[model samples]
Target: MDQEKVNILLVDDQPAKLLAYEVILKDLGENLVIASSGREALEVLLKTEIAVILVDVCMPELDGFELAAMIREHPRFQKTAMIFISAIQVSDIDRLRGYEMGAVDYVPVPVVPEVLRAKIKVFAELYRKTRELERLNHELEDRVRARTAELEASTAKLRESEQRRSMAIAAGKMGSWDWDWISGDWMWDEGQYRIFGVSPEDFEINPANVQARLHPDDVDQLRKAIAEFNKGTRAYETEFRIVRPDGEVRWCVGTAAATMDENGRVVRVSGVTVDITERKRAEERQNLLAREVDHRAKNALALAQSIVRLTRADEVKAYVNAVEGRINALARVHTILSLSSWQGAELSRLIDEELAPYSLGEQIKLAGPEVQLLPATAQTLALALHELFTNSAKYGALSTRAGRLAIDWQVDDELLTLSWEESGGPLVKTPQSRGFGTRSLLASIESQLGGQAQFDWRAEGLLCRLEVPLTRKTAAAAPGKFDTAGSAELQRASG
Candidate 1:
């Protein structure tokens, strides 16, 4: 049964009869509202939600039958149960009329309260159960939708991972092969045969023939790798040079794992082989390029020094200093580019490297979000920092041991502000004339970066600020990018 109280409406024309019914049904534990007339009862029903209605049939004007007919005509009250109560003896025709007016049952005057209470309890329980079932159904539908969405996301991730793996294998020119130790059977993929430079008809499919193809210098290494695999300490991985029939020497990487039987005896070995010939060639080419770059860099520095010497004069010292500073700035940019395979440099890394030599033990504060810079932006920034560092080392806070520098930057909308401040130096004064370094710094910021630069020669120390448009694509692809493996190989070859 529903724990909530049921609301009932009692309608009668006699006040004495209404009082008597209220006293009788007081122990029913339901909410009861009494109305004196059918018109008043209908008005109450329209304003409130009545679960059941008890009406008097023998009244004047709109009696119980007319009120019941009105309720039945309205679609809102179609489910409300009606009971007709009267003292008159109802014939078959009257009973039929009451039934046609949507009466559930007829109760005579002096009704039995227990019978009405029991019937209303049954309907209340049904309503409660129906509501509970509807709530559970809604929750079940929500859970199903959530689970289906999770399944779809998982499937999409799996498909993307598989596609990436397939692309990697194809791009790297790698293929898998298997060998049975007990049966002495060998199976090779097309890529493996292609890497070995052997036709299917010519392949001997034997261990001895495979060993003969490996370079003599790599035989010991190959044996060591196979020994490790047999001992179960690690998988087999060996790189060796193979001499093809067409007089080409190519490098290949082979990896395999041993499969053991139930008793731990070696049963088979399966792995993949990748052709690394192109990668090796690219490494060699990079080495040559690095050497060429180093030679040209030295030549360029020597040429700048020559210009400085030829133009040397007491009045031209500022010009010479500026030229040397710019040359050094170019060299620093080259160093950073070479380290990143000429891709780009991180702005924070560039700043730290430029200021490290001067701020050895002191606390050097940097405040900004980490940002990357393009090669052109890096060059311009490096030159500007070089000028600032040179000026500090010569005449600013960096000239003393008890000095500190703070570098900070911020980005707002399309503009970036970079500021440098120093303190704890000898009492400073404004310079009488701007030096070559200062003019060069200002010109570089304005012309190269399309920005403004300001210098404040305060009594405490020098302060420089720059405002620039931060419009360049920070993460765009560079022209000459090298992968990690290729860069490592090139470094080794160059060394």
Candidate 2:
């Protein structure tokens, strides 16, 4: 069919006869090879891919029958068709013997060339069809293999996508459920079982089981939400508490929407639930802390006003100004504590917040380890730093444009040491009288933090040093152990 020629082999003992057969088959449009004997024919068959063989019965070493039998024995030539030609009249036994040796047809000598050519043509066409069918079968098999590989790859991608989606839902603490009102069928995601604190196998798709888990006070609210959802008047959105079988109560928020039929009748309900117990508790704690902060701020302002009244002198303006500044500093510390939920404050952040009110130039140097101070310690230190800053601004280093303060702090051997050194100030001398600002600074550091305070007045400038024990209880405890009477005595002596 593809216009490719088929090859035919002719075997005989005489050269003239071989040439005559080749000339007869030349018009048949096939490639023809002529061999003078059975050995020559076999040699030709081995060299070329022959489709049909024509043999002469009488030969020298091997006859046509013997050659046909030999060809059948070889696997490569088993499908080749063989025909025998004889000069003598053939007997029935001779025809049967030729057939047994794999001959398909016999022709007498002086054969009709047209008939012989027609028979060879039939066998050639059959061989061509068999090869074409095999080619088609191989192509079909290759296509099937490619399609199967694509299907396998697609299946793997689908599995990977499902795994990622499931992981995301679990990590977000989201639970989903679907309920069919008509058939009473329910399907819950794995996260739903975890949120309810119930084993998946123990769950029943019934309204009674769901209602049983609700807290006594929350049952009515949950029922109301569900009733409203079923009536089609509203979607289900509610926050309620559920008591687990283990006697632990948890808060959960649930949202549901109904799937309605054409007539607006509810057919299914699908929803998600989330655990919000920890979030609710944190909000409650924040509210309580805010109220406490307000109370403490009021008490601090009252105490400042009392100090101004008791220490007032002929210089009323200066006394009021100093008292107001100190009170404002205390308020700023409280604001920082509130931002941190009263846990603590970063030492550096506290210093920056307190010094923002003063117009100290960038030349004021601060060096320290990064330390977190407790709320009480932050308050005490803020007050002490404010007093020092005020004193320097009025008469010490900060009063002059060229003056500078170098502040440094460190922790060594479980004690915190902070030193403030001033330079470029006028000649320094000890003050004759103890002032409220000086007294407050010494009292807060020594009494509240269980620390020592020392001041040295030198010709160059003033140097203030504080050494505080880095113990947890005295610095952070609600009620500290440092005696107020002893702190007052130390403040008077130091001032």
Candidate 3:
């Protein structure tokens, strides 16, 4: 790159002296400005940045001292280099006065061209160096600010990551620990202290203190796991129980990894212990449910066998239909029980399900308070209801459009009394012999449910009243609702 030029101002009352000064400084490769008077020179200084100013001592209007003083007083030109040029010999006192007015050098008339060029070149180069240093300082400050901002952002991100890690560990009920096997040194974080149910101030962090809290039966298993880890095993896990100071037992699963030294010895161990008490309890409950389900399945199969064996049918089709109908009734009630987690079934829901096919306008009117029956009671009632509805559709109210079946139930103390009345049907007569359907209904209510079933064969219709003794287990079950889609509305008698 080429060197940049600086401006040098020449101020004289005579044109000849101004031309002489410009010619002498032209070979220095700097910009030279000419002004014929002091007033003209001041105007030039305002427009340009002059590095060196050469003014004549004998001026027509403003003398050298006066002009230099005026230039020095102006803020912009205070640091500008000024040299006085006089045609007459200057006394020492006059030179001192010129220096005080900011004259840097004095050049006598018939000045040496080489000496004047050397002085101006020094001052011009000094100004360029000062400006370059200021620019570099500004750049250094900017870089420092940018680096400081980057460090602050990185620190904030790291803090957020650590906070998230801590929250996850706490939520999972996990604790961490580190031990130096060689030095017998132990270290545990806050989570470890919390898991053991001991405060830091009350408990010492050592193997003896930790072992004292271990359940007697689980200590051996833990010892075996640690022994395996010491024999060059990188990973090992064990499940154990801990008895807290307050005698609360907690299940925990521990997993650890060992660091090996050059001699293949275990030097350090790091691990985590997680509370698994809830998981263990859930597993126990699942096992109990499995056994309960197996027992219930066998009972259902036995009930189906009994229905098939005792059913008296003249044809294969009759036998198949009777068996299928009873089985389907069992399945429907089973579905309801499953939906409620085998807790119980609602009495109203059971009635609605069995009467779904026969429901036509107001052909059936049912009124009952909300009642929940235990699993066994629900199953027996489902079969009984199926037999009643089948018998009605064949010979009773559901056989004709004009006939109607009205069923209602109420609970008083521990007994639930339900009445099934068939009105507007053919004239009723007492049967001499009981069929299998009537026998099955009577057996389910009396033998299985311990309830009484009374039949009234009047001239108009058959009215059956069932007095069922609800055990504490049955009436205490909480009432539940299931989706009985497309079922008729039953009258609910609030109690």
Candidate 4:
């Protein structure tokens, strides 16, 4: 389709005629091929793509009619425009033959130069336009194929990405939404309807519908947050509570950002929401436990200060020893408390921990059902037990070889009744004065633990009775814990 390089073949037997024809068509701005005979013309046709061929009728071997027939027989040359030039006058039969051979025109010898030039110009222009159209058609076909491939690839990537996003959102218990400010229509994915506890058919995701289900306290706060986001003041991030139709409350956290228009105005808001009710409940419980631990610390400090102030021993060393021993007893009760995550401690283990230093045999007997006491009650009773054991070992039952002590407790109704009595010891006598040991025990049992204790000075032994009120308040069983020792024989669930 190179316009400047279109081929034109000129065939004549005489050298003079060939020169004359070339001179006539030299100004046409096309490559011209000269053939001295029909055979030579066929060779030219084979080598080059010809737009037009002018052949002489009188030739030694192949005439103009024969050349035209050869050109028509080949498919590539079927559309090649052919013109025949005869030097002698043509017969009607010869003219018909030229026409039958696919000749468009027959030029006579002494041909008019202007008419021949005009005819060649017409065919040359037609050739240029035809090649140009063919080129354009090929280019269009290539472009369409490339565009189709691009679209197919883009669609595949989009489908793959959407599948991954849906899986991630479902696993995370999250939902996505889009709000168009101009249309006032909401668009939600499958996850959004599920998180809100609504079926897709019944769900009306509008501003009013959203506000209606929110907790009364959080509605205004969420609105304010969104308003600020629209005003270009802050990024949207907030947590709020939602009330379900069945009257259950759940917490949710939302975050959104705005898409801006060309004029820098808000166009749409897109965001995600997640259910966080369980996490919020856990946080509340942790805060309450922190406060309770702080209260225990303050009370323990006050009790220790009282112990130091009230001890009336004559020697400083004896007083220090007594305080140290009482504090260790309190620490043993604290061990069981930590094991149960500050829930409570078993009563029988507390008894064994206090009496471990003394010989644990028939001389010292203990019997009690498994009772889990509150941390405060355990701490108070641990100090009292320390005093009782020290007294029995020094001057009471355990002071003699045949001495025996029995400590037993039983729960009846809401009261825990405990008794401590000593027998098989030296003749018992009452002390002349009440010491810090007796006072501390009385104060801890009565004031700290909210319980009562009585002492009886009898001839055979000293008897002490304590009654404590049990309440039905506390947490469920602590996780990852086992019952303390000696609980297997006396263990029983609360009745």
Q: Highest TM-score among the candidates is held by which one?
A: 3
On the 0 to 100 scale, the lDDT of residue 241 in model 2 is 86
> Residues 210-318, candidate 4, lDDT per residue (tens digit)?
8888899999977797779667752588898888777788889998888888877778888898888778999999898888787766655655665555554657776
TM-score of each: 0.40, 0.55, 0.70, 0.63
Per-residue C-alpha lDDT of model 1 across residues 1-495, encoded as one tens digit per residue? 546666778888999878877776677677889999888988898898777787889888888899999989889788787878878888889999999999888877567777755665555555455556878998999989989999999999999997776676678877678889799899987667777889789897687887777888887876786677677643677787887778788888888888988877778889888889898899999998889677656544553454344322244555556555556656777788778876677778778777766645654678997766666567667767866776566566666777677889987886778899977766777767655455546655666567889988777877889876667543222211201011001110000
lDDT of each: 0.71, 0.77, 0.80, 0.77
lDDT of 3 by residue, 62-121 (tens): 888999999999998888889899899999999999999999899887888988888778
Regions of model 2 farther than 4 Å from truth: 1-49, 59-75, 86-122, 174-176, 214-243, 247-374, 377-435, 438-495
Ranking by TM-score: 3, 4, 2, 1
Pairs in clash, predicted candidate 3: none
Q: How many clashing residue pairs, candidate 2? A: 0
- Clashing pairs for model 2 are none
Minimal lDDT window, size 10, model 4: 479-488
* Per-candidate count of clashing residue pairs (backbone under 3 Å): 0, 0, 0, 0
Model 1 residue 129 CA deviation in Å: 3.2
RMSD for all candidates, in order, please: 22.8, 9.9, 7.4, 9.7
- Candidate 4 ranges beyond 4 A from true positions: 1-164, 229-234, 472-495
Whole-model lDDT, candidate 2?
0.77
Model 3 TM-score on a 0 to 1 scale: 0.70
